[model samples]
Target chain A: MTSLVLAALLYATPAPQANVFTLETHWRAEDGSDRAFSTLKGRPFVLAFIYTSCPGTCPLTTAKLKRLDAALKAQKTPLPMVVVSLDPEHDTPQAVHHYRERYALEHAEHWSVFVGAEAALRTLTQLLDFKYAQNPESKQIMHDNTVYLISRGGEVLTALSSLDDSSAPLLEQAAQSEGKQR
Target chain B: MVRLAALAIGVLLSSATRAEGVLLPEGRFAPLFGLDKGQRSFAVAAFRLDRRLVTEAAFAAFLRSKPEWSSASVKPALADERYLSQEGGAAYAQAPQTRVSWFAAQAYCEWRGGRLPTTLEWEYAAAADEKVRDASTDAAFVKRILTWYGKPFRREDLLGSGSLANVYGVEQLHGLVWEWTLDFNGTFMTSDNRQDGDRVNALTCGNGATGSARREDYAAFMRYALRSSLSARSTLANLGFRCAYPATEERSP
Candidate 1:
């Protein structure tokens, strides 16, 4: 149908290539650069999904990521990070920066914060195997507190639940990748 | 003069639409599956669904166009080793191509000028029996569906894409393969489903019902459970998919 053709064209924007790089999906980083996901490569990165206003799991997820961040620092390993916002409406660039400051992770290695159009968010989340839903009534987003470890080659190494004490393996993998890159 | 011009435009549009599939009109659908709020009704926008389950031949044709999606070319991260493992070449070409990941299904649909239907849209359309809508409560109908549910999918089954037409003229939605919804992972659940006391209560009826929420709907409940268990890269021997698109000029406003 002509409508189907039109829909396909609409979806044929910049990305959704069904690959790990997802490099074509563009976003506005907290620092205000028009960046693509491919630019986030060349270092072992941790991709964590959170929204600033989440009262439940989002905070816990960050705390867990921060712990991992601290451990990586202690081990002299640089963990490049990108904490994506599930609620770009509330967690704007300014809010993400505030979060960075609040966590005292401002000086941490490459923990770039981002807020962008829902389309880029969806593409990234889908590639990361993340599932999230926003509840308008409760004003809370329902999702898993998931953290993904990305290898230097852009493969998603593993997806770990943030509530667990199982950062040991992820830490070791990231450290090894860090050594190879240097 | 305006009326005549509008009619002329409509004539041209109908002719254009006739080039492919038919449109299922807009309606209010209480999905028997998916992120359902208890007794909550949701809108099903007007859309067009491909009349058939994507067949192996169709997929093979798709692969010819998208070399990167070929079984040998796709990396393990994007797809598993079992992708097209049993491809019998032209012999089994018409069989419904199973053992495909969600990404592959999406790409196939995109190539076909549509997309994989959302769980809500799939459920909304499937609730109909031949000649009646919302046959969910119809005992005979539900029993027939359950029969297919209990029946195991034989790998040898061929997808003709012309049988078992529902009221909307959609085919092979059931008694065929478990089709993939575009956002299959959106159905959420707690790992500790057996948790006792307040924890269980909060997880279940917290916002509304989730994971085995509609226990009475044994079939639909199982579907949700299966969907939640699968990751985006999961491929199955019995799972395939169909495509859909928003209806032309769908003025939801």
Candidate 2:
């Protein structure tokens, strides 16, 4: 009977794959719509975390994303990009709009900017192994500057630091993911 | 006599609910890491902390309630292969539940209407001794903690073994399993170097130690290093966690 029970338990176990969409989190998109991360599944996308008001590496990360977007477009394998805010308290819809305009992402249909409460953000960030902490006094966020290429199943296929590493690897994987989707 | 009995029952109910955890007063503490430039100490708010580590039986109860977090169902990305390997039998019911990933710990705390304590808050509460609060600077106390750290770990030791209650009435901070903090991955060494325009190789050259507030506090340093080394999914046999809750607002009579 114990062996039979063990076999049943073994059969019940599901195949393990890391999918960020599996996390239960909600966010407000730049368009003022409440969306669950699962909505982004079934399509390959580039994911990055940044706050609209970050004075340091965030702007660099945005510029890097733009460059990656243009590079992927040239390869005819354009993937949608997701930019989540680390400072959800300050990254209101208006702030995200201004940020999109400032970075010339206003007309980019493939780009999405999202802001959510800290708890939801933490759930996503922890899933991706992204680290961030906000200073209590200065309110400036210290964070890693990695850009990820997520597969259609929401697994991180490749990640590269925006400041130090070239986006060539991420671009290659994103192109491959786009090809698979097609 | 009837009125007195009713009042006594009311007091008993209140104390029973409160016995699950202990309240720690607000204070400032200088942790081993995460201090900004020229920042000395972090101001921690008053909070309630669990009196003991979560036990195997408690975790079993959680797994029963949330089957998705069970070893068979949890995603590999959220917890490693060793997740919940310690079986909860009658013999080990009271033992501290180890081999739990940070995500599982967080979920358990949330289910209990609380959250994992921040690193600063955990360190501040842990600094207290049995008689004196903030005994982190006492050389003898530091030595005793270091001794505990050096002792060879045995899983059997987790049973019926824990530190005496500190000033906050919280026990088992040391000489027990390592606990998870809310932001265990928030170690700012490599990321801070990029912000300061310093080469990443500087961390390898022992420059990370230069930012520590107390170089002699090797126990704290080890804890910080362990926290930095762990991913959200990493689980260790000697690692467990307790929950913390926001302090209730005091009202004047």
Instruction: Give me the candidate number with maximum DockQ.
Output: 2
Candidate 1 per-residue C-alpha lDDT over B112-172 given as tens digits, one digit per residue, 9 for 90 to 100: 5667877878878887889886776667877777766666555665544423788888878
lDDT of 2 by residue, B1-253 (tens): 9978966764564345346678888778888776778888788888999888888867776787799999999978778788888754688877888889888998998877678888888889888999998888788888988888777677777885778899988889998888899988776644234543312322333665766787777777767766765777878777899988879923212
Clashing pairs in 2: none
Residue B206 in model 2: lDDT: 65
True contacts kept of each: 0.15, 0.25
C-alpha lDDT of all candidate models, in order:
0.68, 0.79
Write the residue-wise lDDT of candidate 2 on A1-182 in tens digits.
Answer: 12322332343333355568867889997778899988988888888999999998899999988998899899998889899999988898889999989998889998999899766787788887788887765678888888888888888788785477878898788777777667
Question: What does the interface RMSD come to for each candidate?
Answer: 10.9, 9.5
Clash count, one per candidate: 0, 0
Deviation of model 1 at B205, angstroms: 18
> Which residues of candidate 1, in runs, are more than 4 Å off?
A1-34, A66-78, A87-109, A114-128, A133-140, A155-160, A164-182, B1-22, B32-39, B87-95, B160-163, B189-213, B248-253
lDDT (C-alpha) at residue A112 in model 2: 93
